[model samples]
Target: MVSVSASLAIAATLPARAEDPPPQLTGDWGGWRTELANRGIEFQIGYTEEAAGNASGGQHNYVRAAGQLVLGSTLDLQKLFGVSGATMQITLTNRNGRNLSDDAGLNTLQQVQEVYGRGNIWRLTQFWYEQKAFDGAVALKFGRVTLGEDFAAFSCNFQNLTFCGSTPGNLAGNYWFNWPLSQWGARLKVKSGQVYVQAGAYQVSPRNSDPDRGFYLGWEQTSGALLPVEFGWTPTVGGLPGKYTATLWYDTSHANDVLRNRQGLPLAVYGGDPRREQGRYGVSFQFQQQLTRPDVADPVRGLSAFLNITQTDRRTSQTDNQIAFGLFYTGWLDSRPRDVMAIAIGRTQVNGRYAENQALANFNARGFLQRPEAEYAIEAYYNLNLHSGLDIRPNIQFIRHPGGITNAKDVLVLGVKAIVNL
Candidate 1:
């Protein structure tokens, strides 16, 4: 059961006003969705589709279509059965289709679309129980949970994965899986005024990512645990609201070095031997601020900017650091108050040691060449509010040094996305 405070906390950063009308698609249920929500049971269903392709300067030119479906529900125990401050949530996700980056050999760190994944399959994403205490000042949640649901939360208004939820996903994907992937975990948070501090302990096991293990909960193969702590501050700027968050994470599992052998020599020079180390860690910062507020005549008109940055342990990760900045403008036109436009740029720095290893490999195998250092991408999009429950977005992206490899040519990608709410 999700508490009222929990719901409000999640919606705090959204640009939508509280007085906005309910979605028309939900109203089509004969007011059943609203009625159910008022009675402590809330249902959610949504579908998103993306078509993307690299039009120029890649290993190849190809287009791909991807789609995802999400179904979820939340229950408030306090309202339904007088259970004090208890809440529960359940969610399932289904993903299918091909990835444009893979098809076109872009080899970029950021995905073109947020819906792309490893496979086309249905999986249980979240089933968590939360309890609040001390006049809603403290809360506890546990079960199959996702890190993104509570920590460093951000909206996915852009098509580029770089601007999506959680900066750690780009810096530490091995240990910090984002939404649509849940693991056994628990989180505790305490709120005081506009500030909150939270910490979580999550299971770290590669088996949890196996699509075939959907809904499976087994601890026998667990390698270790990931501990994350976050501090958040909410403030008002020029009468507009904003949120700033900083998070740190440490994983207790053993991680293999990407480039070095046991003797600290490059793997290419050590006949491909491996070296393993323990204790991986990373840090991330996120800031989202509304620069302008909407007026009575344009309730949905506003502008906001966001920045995300992350740094990971260089010894075990190919990408040592990543930074992204973006701006979002809603109600670009007076007639289309729900429409949005945005642009963003991101850079992923290749780990120096890993680049040296690759350079050594290339020199030994063929000839001499300078090592790759980083990859950069810029993306822009316009979202059209076709209907109350539907949005269509057209996007373009420019990639320089795809995959952080010099051999990969600069590329331009075009894409479109459609989302349906039910």
Candidate 2:
């Protein structure tokens, strides 16, 4: 919904300056905005909305709309209080409306309307303090935080859940919390030339994502913790920017096996409770590069590609793995330098063990359950940047084997997304 993670990630890599900020719909506000900037305070507001409807397939056809509004501000303590290399950020988000996948009956593994979920309510998205050292090569952040904001973070520029945000959070979401959710945690990032290493430990409590706990800052009902480490390379290859990263993560919390009983037999057949596991582990990779640039000087006008892969522990995960890739062309036409056209394909694979359990359950129940394999999604969109602070994107999606069922009808969906920098 709101991109507090993306903002924090970018802030970690760059130092705040005592200068005018980016343009917004309300420019300057006379001299007040300039006065605030001089005092190291800057405010930002963003709104995103998605509307989608299924044209074919699914259990029924329906249309739904969802939206999010984010309000945030950053304070540079170095300029405000003479505390060098220190900054603070606070953000609040409000999300509302329904999900197309559920309302439209497109029972796919991922949602076509990515902006929905995490309940329709208000949330304290971010509240963190960061300090940079060694000339911006090292950054340490703590307080209310999310692991996805720093490690395995990806741009949420797409409308499909399969192609948006953090891949690990999508696959292993039982433990990994993404944006609009915060937990007690800390993260450290160290950069050396083109290579960087980052690590974080975050609270693994389910309360963080609870709708009622949006403003609850206490550590009550806490589980264990989540630890993640990442290694990355950001290079200018052939004068084109590229980023490659690998992440390894573990959760100390205990989770139940998806399929097995306490005796290690299929719980579906045995009619017993699933076995409890002590820990869970996962790995993920991200690759993004600007493949072609018509104008060497204009970095924004180019063809960029991205690939994401994530694998979770088989013992506790149903959707254990996912692979997604996409390409977006910016300024393909000289007349529309800010326009973008993009297409993406993604597959979410059901864990084989889970599938076996499902088969056993189906056999026991006389084929009441659907045996799943993998769900695939294809999405394409054209983004019209009508002005500096507004963009409208029209998109289409094709979902194959919804819920990974071979007999299920493929779904076709149409959608539109609007974004405003308020």
Candidate 3:
């Protein structure tokens, strides 16, 4: 997650120079970008490309590329029309490409590329209106929104999905969709000096992910509501800042039991009768801290670490729990202030009930077998900032167990990601 204070510090160091042009691929539209910002309308456009392949240990070796285009705009009500404390944001996204996970037959739970999702489709990602009141202590937002954008907001500096976005959303994807797939939702937040509380209610519907229904806003087949609450603390340690957040989410929807039958026995052994349950829930904790302060000459360079953990109801979740931690260093070399290096490790634990079911199925179908358990992944990358608006990251990942299945061999993956601001 990017801290507000850290963003401010970076901005403070980049004072505009009359002689230098704006740092954008489009060259600030010949100063039009600044003119529009002054008038309260800010537009943004970007594209990201990821190419990945499994070099060893998967079912097959294949290379694939995924691409995403994002277009967005933000309008400030106060500056545009003299309306106080209100703003509106709109974003559109398009994704195209084949997924490496499926292509290589490496059943890794977390995706290899953060940009690969519901591929080859266009969708309205975000359209929200926010208003602030009570001297900016309270805020309210509503409309098509993704819960991850506000709560448990994690950075996407790494290529792996495990280290990107909200942990709960990554673990409980069936119910909690992350970015590029939003639903009707609203959020309210209240903040004080160093602490804050926030809550949200969102529509839960699987149909929202269907590309054919990309623009569908109807409540048809709506299962139930997804409600979330979070509390956060921001503190300064040794003059450096940190943020800690805890979140709880409950989906008041009917969920099918993963392993149980109507008689509460293993579904595979009980005539394949499925059992259904109401409500699904999860919890997550996230922490990001600046470990080393940057020197006065390079306010944008520093060392930071992050940890995220999430647990979901085992009976209803495919992956019951996930934990990830990582460290990142910016500007390790004074000459390359825009460069960053990071390493992260993540583990996804299979649900015990699901494992038992798999074991039973294997025994019945194959006569002898091992059950699924957990998968572990570790990744490291160096982000080379080619320019203010361009970045290229080369990364590698090792997977101890590709699919949580005991027989699955370890896998090694190599990839590169490129992001451009247009």
Per-model tally of clashing residue pairs: 5, 0, 0
Best by lDDT: 2
Write the residue-wise lDDT of candidate 3 on 1-422 in tens digits. Answer: 11111121232122111112224567678889889988988776778899999999767899999988878788889999998999888888888998889888888878887788854788888888999998889999999987787777776667788887678888798889887888999999999998999999999998888866667677888999999999999888786777899999999999989999878888867756678888999899988788886686664578888889999998799889999988888888889887888899999888888888888888899898668888888999988888877778899988887678767888898999887766
Candidate 2 wrongly placed segments (more than 4 Å): 1-23
Q: Which stretches of candidate 3 lie over 4 Å from their true place?
A: 1-23
Per-residue lDDT for 379-417 in model 1, tens only? 898888787667788999888887787667788989998
| TM-score (C-alpha) between model 3 and the true structure | 0.94
- My TM-score estimates for the predictions, one after another, are 0.93, 0.95, 0.94
Most accurate candidate by TM-score: 2
TM-score of 2: 0.95
The better candidate by TM-score, 2 or 3, is: 2
**Could you list the CA RMSD of all candidates, in the order they appear?**
3.3, 3.0, 4.0
Candidate 2 lDDT (Cα, whole model)?
Answer: 0.82
lDDT (Cα, tens digit) per residue for candidate 2, span 1-422: 32632321121112112132433666678888779978999887888899999999887889999999888898999989999999998888889998889876788998898888887888888899999999989999998875666787777777889988778888887678887888889989899999999998899888888976678798777879899999999899888778899999989988999988899888998868889999999999998887787987776687888889999999999999999988888887989887888899999999988998988888788957668999999999988878766778899999999988889999999999887775
RMSD of 1: 3.3
Clashing pairs in 1: 1-75, 1-87, 1-88, 2-87, 2-88
